[model samples]
Target chain A: MVRVHNLFLSSDGYGAGEGQSLERPFGHANPVELGAWAFGAASWPNRTDGAGTRGLEDYLVRDFHRNVGAEIMGRNKFSPCRGPWEDHPEWEGWWGEDTPFHTPVFVMTHYERPALTLTDTTFHFVSGTPEQVLERALEAADGKDVRLGGGPETIRQFLDAGLVDTLHAAVSPIELGGGSRLWTSPEELDDRYHHDVVPRPDGVVHHLFWRR
Target chain B: MVRVHNLFLSSDGYGAGEGQSLERPFGHANPVELGAWAFGAASWPNRTDGAGTRGLEDYLVRDFHRNVGAEIMGRNKFSPCRGPWEDHPEWEGWWGEDTPFHTPVFVMTHYERPALTLTDTTFHFVSGTPEQVLERALEAADGKDVRLGGGPETIRQFLDAGLVDTLHAAVSPIELGGGSRLWTSPEELDDRYHHDVVPRPDGVVHHLFWRR
Candidate 1:
């Protein structure tokens, strides 16, 4: 199954901003507010130190990587570089040598780059249709589920192609004013999915959608 | 205090549709789905037959009229005739003589029309800014709260003006592909209000906002 887990969105449905740069990945949006829930969750892998919240937030953060074997992301999610990749050969990525995805990670971009291996993670830059890239990731995932780690545009591509089975979105109680919108209305996917909303006291609502 | 109650929106934040007409109050969108929660609530005064759901939906529906003594709406919401009032003399409104709003209803418009009284409900066609109309409505409301009955644009006008004290929106699971958007994100109101999300088993999430 292709599942989108722990994707944070502003109340306006924006997953990221328009001018995502190396300096401002979310473009004027405070990155801290966007993913504040996950950051405050004790189970976030990046939180090796004493940081994050407990309970549902922590459980959800911890559940993000469970039973996942591989990941597919947009090149933008991998790095802020756009158009061609030759301009920034020195840019390894936002993540250091020890990347989060321990499994094979395929990055979709028009510009092709050679595969780079870091620890258990192997970053493979590929240019193809969502289906073509999914095929490779599914193979790498073996029988396990594949995770769609995104910058919204990548996840939207998979969603538009009807390649997603499950999606979990954490909607923060803030507006970004302007950014890259995910779904204009989740009802656009109603033909293929059943939606459930889970509300929490922290002012965030968990919108879950699964294939009907 | 001005309160907006029982306003329902799609997950995308559309409260009504564009090109609203008398035949289609919510434009191309299904009016039933947009306000389905209110229809199924036992508290809905319009529900003559054994319709509406029990519990929270009913409670919220019943709460719509609790302290409301008057209503403020845009001209389009009162009647389908756009541009001028003289264009449609025969046109009363989408609601018949016995309109749902039993109190003095102030209709904001550019063209002025004499006040039309029907039963306990009186429709006053007045032209003024949000603040000006609000002044009249507040006076007519006496000591009770004034209700901001909307068509999205009207509610947004009040929201933008920072006049609404309490806002309750029921987000239906269904989506209207195209319509008038309510908030780019509820977070736009975060500067002045606190937001709360309450999920109901009916596949609708109740979004409550109040001035901080």
Candidate 2:
């Protein structure tokens, strides 16, 4: 099953705010604020100080790599550089050095490029519709479930196509007035998915969904 | 202090849906669905069965009338009938026989009419801006706190004017595609108020706000 987990969505349904640039991947949004629950969790994988709280939030952060194999993400998630690869050839990605994924990472892009390996992760730049991309990711996943990495629009494309199997969207309390919205209301998915709102004591609500 | 409590907001930040009329007070939205948490509570005063569940929701329901000496609402809250007083002279509120608001109720309307008293509550059809209406409500509240009763737009008016002191907005998990929105995002009020999101064990999240 294709899955999405630990994704932080702003209260206004934005995966990332407007004005995205090389300096600011989340655009006008402060990623630290939106991912407060995850950043504050003791189980956070990338913690520098190694000091954070534990509970449901910690559990979510720790569970980020449970059973995911190959990961699929949009072009923007791969780099701040937009358009063709010639615009910016140097693409090390936002995740410095050793990236999180230990499997093949499919970067859905219009421009194709030779697969680049960084530490344990391999970045494969490919172009296709949501279906085409998911098929390639699933093939690379071997027997493990393919993870659908997102920035909202990527997930939305799959959602509109009814290709997603399960999803865990963390609705952050912060709001961005204008941005790319995944949904006006989550109820839009009720026809195809069963949603369970898991409210953590820390006030971060996670919307869990599975195809019905 | 002027407070707004137990106000239900859709996942998209709407207070009420479109197509509002006498038959549908909340427009296309279901009032039962919106008030499910409170209505299901054991302490719900309006529970006819005398049997219900307990917890934070129950506490909020029972706390509804506490220290509330008066209520300020939009004309639509008083009745679905719009336009001048000539449209619908029979202005009995949607609350039925004994209204929940025992305190003096100020209904802000452009077309003013004589005050109507129902059982323990008195509905004053007053005209003025949000500030003017609030002033009258505060006066009617005596020494007790005033409650800003809303239908979404009403609360937004007070919010825009910075007249609201405290607010407890219940963010329901359900989503209504469109309606009267209190906010595009809860963060809009962060400039003037400190907001705390209290998540209930039952999956409901309440946003509590107070002037900084």
Per lDDT, the best of the predicted structures is 2
B1-212: candidate 2 lDDT, tens digit per residue: 78887898887898899988888999999888888878877567677896664334544666567678999998877787878966668868888878888989999999978888889999998998998988888899998989988979999999888888778888888889998889888888889886766666655677877777
Off by over 4 Å in 1: B1-212
Compared with the real two-chain complex, what DockQ does model 1 have?
Answer: 0.02
Q: Pick the candidate with the highest DockQ.
A: 1
lDDT of 1 at A79: 86
Every model: Cα RMSD to truth: 19.1, 18.4
Query: Which tens-of-lDDT digit does each residue in A1-212 have in candidate 1?
Result: 89888898988888887787889877777878888878866568788786444334554676567679899998888887888876677777788987888999999999887899988899999999999999999999999989999978789999989999878888999887777777766667778887666677778887777776
Instruction: Give the B-chain TM-score of model 2.
Output: 0.95
Estimate the TM-score for candidate 2. 0.51
